[model samples]
Target: MNKPFADKLRKIASYVPGEQPQCAGRIKLNANENPYPPSPRVAAALRDFDAATLAFYPDANAHRLKNALAAQNGLKASQVFVGNGSDDVLALAFQSFFCSDQPILYPDITYSFYPVWCGLFRVPYETVPLGADFRVNPRAFDRRSGGVLLPNPNAPTGIGEPLALLEDILRHNADCVVIIDEAYVDFGAESAVSLLPKYENLLIVQTASKSRSLAGLRVGWAFGSETLIGTLEAVKNSYNSYTLDAVAIEAAAASVEDDAYFRKTCKQVMDTREASAEALRALGFSILPSQANFLFATHPQKNAAELFEALRAQNIFVRYFDLPRIDNYLRITVGTDAQMARLTDALKTILS
Candidate 1:
């Protein structure tokens, strides 16, 4: 007799991430990764790590990282939670808040992982279509259920919703959790974190990946009411007690305190994104205004899939999705000024 897999596991499609290669020297702008190095203090933490701790199991609650994040966000440690990445924090949110009969509602074009997480946890979900301009129409969320999940400065499109509109959603979203994924908040958009105290249901999830440039360290955090954090902590405890490594905790703590480095790097990336967006528009590409560390540009005359492959041939990589509504667009990460120059030159040649 053959043993069967769980029915829940059988039906779901897991998240498919962008290309991460063993081969180096490729201009990788596919994923919204920070091109600048993380804070120098982060390196110091790693270099001076406690070697004796290797033999001991890490602090399962990760009190060190939590304390640091809490202090940085001006919240109590009880209102904070950390995970392997913001994706992990989001996964726990799905399990803790969305374990309901109602369907989780999100923009049809938002982070692809929202639906993937829903499927993974057997949560019911519904997708509301974005507007003709690919912006999340606030009115679409007026009627909702289990919870609300959205990425601000939403990925692939890089279009952001104003803070005023998000506050309105909080007023209306009293039934369940409202999760704001602020992975790209540092670049331009105003973060929804300030509303955390007023809205008990709000959970603002962020990562060290973009602004902190600690993607390699895989640190993510969630800020909300202590009760919501407790619920997520329960889920995290049930999954993996030691959700973060020792080195990661130290690096994250250091990175959060090094605001000077973070601000400088974000400014650099923002300046380049504006310049790059203009360049793409001049090249006949319709560029979406981005608040993130990347842009979503679609050439009216060129096939996006073709562009994906052609850019790969030039050793330049950007993200291209086969999903509905965004298939024609190229989600290009904002790299250094030099990298953007190389991409523009390549586009000119390809368009010519």
Candidate 2:
């Protein structure tokens, strides 16, 4: 450990990302990354791109990407903000909107990054507990909080709360910002974007990483009122002017323009998610009804830690968090049919 670090930095408990294994014949379902390739237009754009622009700095504002995103979401460019990824967008949001004496609110079992961001930004936060069924209780969020943030089709649990309940939470907390991270929205979950016009304080953050199959490119955005978007831009400019590179801007625009391919890939993942859930349930696992591309499941008779290790031994990886309440569960990403079939076969052998 390095000496004389900032006391706050030393106290911060960093977030642990899913493993990225480099092994032969690995079936990776650990991270909720899309199994499909990015839109062919992305490659076409890259191929046709002029390398000469690489000599100059990329656009600081990323106007083209923001405009495309705004057009796709039926909003103006002024109401859109893009970042390196949704993680960056989220960090900016934490810094911009959550600077209050009151504590921010999020689900106890929501995205692990929430707490990490709060700590990094020095924002006080309180975690509202999810219900016994692993669903959010929106009423618990009616308190006077600095802000509210939670992922739709909530991570690790992969269960989505209805828009009505989400609206109820937004209604109660109209004075503060409510960030609905729809990172997996395209999988099957209804986006809170529909409620954006009604609630000015609402911000819906999404990523091209999952549905658009551009994780490596790291593009993400947020849609909200012009006022909210302006705040994020202010924070972003203060943080990093050239957050996204030129290639990423062009590729993201191309991907968003090719709506057909995006829909096809998202539908494929959702279809595979449903089938995989059924397969896990048939294997004596209690799988959550997931609207995301991943499933949260636990077996009644088998130990989750053992299963996670066993799957890893067979070169098949899934996400397992040894946290309280969810220590018994495994969050499995939906891979291709063949990949999932291999996972199923591997599980059958483990169970037998």
Q: TM-score winner among the candidates?
A: 2
Give candidate 2 misplaced runs (Cα > 4 Å): 1-10
Model 1 regions more than 4 Å off? 1-9
Q: List TM-score per model, in order.
A: 0.96, 0.97
lDDT by residue for model 2 (267-321), tens: 8998888888888889999998898989999999999999999999999999999
Residue 310 in candidate 2 has what lDDT?
98
Query: How well does model 1 score by local distance difference test?
Result: 0.89
Span of ten consecutive residues with least summed lDDT in model 1: 1-10
Q: TM-score of predicted model 2? A: 0.97
| Per-residue lDDT value at 120 in model 2 | 82
